[model samples]
Target chain A: MKGASEWDRHAPSSAPNPRHTRYHPRWHRERIPIFWWVGHRRYTLFILRELTAVLVLYSGLLLLAQLVAIGRGPESYQAFQGWLAEPWVLALHTFVLLGLIFHTVTWLNLAPKALVLRVGKIRVPPRAVLVGHYLAWIAVSALVAGALVWVAG
Target chain B: MSPVAKGAGGRQGTEPERVTRSREPLLWSLFSAGGMASALVLPALAGVLWVAVPAGWVAAPEHGAMLAVAAHPLTRAAVSLLLILFFFHWAHRFRYTLYDGLQLYHLNLLIAVATYGIASALSALALWIVWTLG
Candidate 1:
């Protein structure tokens, strides 16, 4: 404990107390680059997953626009549908569909990680949780499809 | 649950400390629920509306038929719920993405308000549209 001034004796010492440098230097953290996610496959995919929210928001807005069109009258609806039938619109939607499907897959895969289900002290298997989500997806999709095609049609 | 009471209460007589309820769990629940809701429905809806019907892979429903479906109380409820959840999901994910990906922790309050405020506004718009849709 003698010679407490040893740290201050070193050149370029701004810290007044020897104890400061004796324990450690000033805390430093490396800055993260802006494009840190670039070129990293897993990270890229993760960003893509995050990016899918854009498509999801787009889809939500798109449907609301459709409903608004419907409310405006059959002519308005027809015109809206006409715009959708355009090749470019269909192409854009094709991309949207792919992105949303990817979202669904990743969501199902990650569901069990968040939802810990147990039945009387016996934890439900993660595989079962995943299977349950998939089955729910299929059922919901089937019902919506049937409603759109059969009931609504 | 406070850390002291949340964990197995091994300390002699430590009372459960009152914890401030954070909205995080609520937002997270919305995010996941929104994700699940959109996942289960968005593809079907978008595929049918955007791709299949528009592209003629599926015959376009009778004009009145689709409108009638949209007008239904049940369908309106579902649409409102889905749209609201979708925006919230987007808000939560995009907020975190902006924070971590862009390192905008310095603007945390601004980011949270902007993200969730936009989501809430859009949800109101969706509800209005759904309400007057009949």
Candidate 2:
């Protein structure tokens, strides 16, 4: 009994029952390949969408830094601007700009799916929903630009 | 073997399993909201700041003018919200990227906590800076 208890203690928990074992044909479940996104166009695009978050983070940090620079006075603000004027900074901005555009386009395309707008008994068409998003976007941008111009002038 | 025995054996061998529910829906909602907001505003913001100003396509606002905009109460509020949402947006995307891209679902709890914590901290810092700006 002592030896049996010791053996049980060292044995695997929930051992397979021999009585339950049967000759069942195993189904081959395909494992996800490492480059799964590369296999499909949509997958690649989805990955790119996921990637644009990095650019978003970058822009957020840049804006925060600019705010801090502004608070630090005119010399610091000018220094920040000078740093942004560097060629490498310009190149990085170009890539970030492209990423932001891709992010916006993909996001707009998905808006219709996520948003179900209805007026009374009528459901708004998907195309109309997309158009509304674009129009609103343009209006907001124009408002900001106008404000900036007004402040500057 | 009899039908009863065969059925018993099959039932013992393969029972339906319950899947664990994930607590990701809450984070996903913030991600969706942030994505929508950024989609609308970020492109234009990036266009003017990174493209037009840098390329000399538009006159860059003077430092004082830019400072005035930044110091405006409405501008500060909007920017703070935008930055916070953007950070959360990045946090959610990055968490999923790690989960699916690198197959880090085993560390889901840790990753979620860490990512959201960082985002919250950064958002607080950004808000403080924006609020305290003269």
Query: Candidate 1 overall Cα lDDT vs. reference?
Result: 0.83
- Say which candidate scores most in TM-score: 1
Cα RMSD, model 1: 9.0
lDDT of 1 by residue, A26-120 (tens): 56999889789999999989989998999989998999998898888889989999999999988999999999999999999998998899999
Clashing pairs in 2: none
DockQ of 1: 0.34
The C-alpha local distance difference test score for the whole of candidate 2 amounts to 0.80
Model 2 residue A94 CA deviation in Å: 1.6
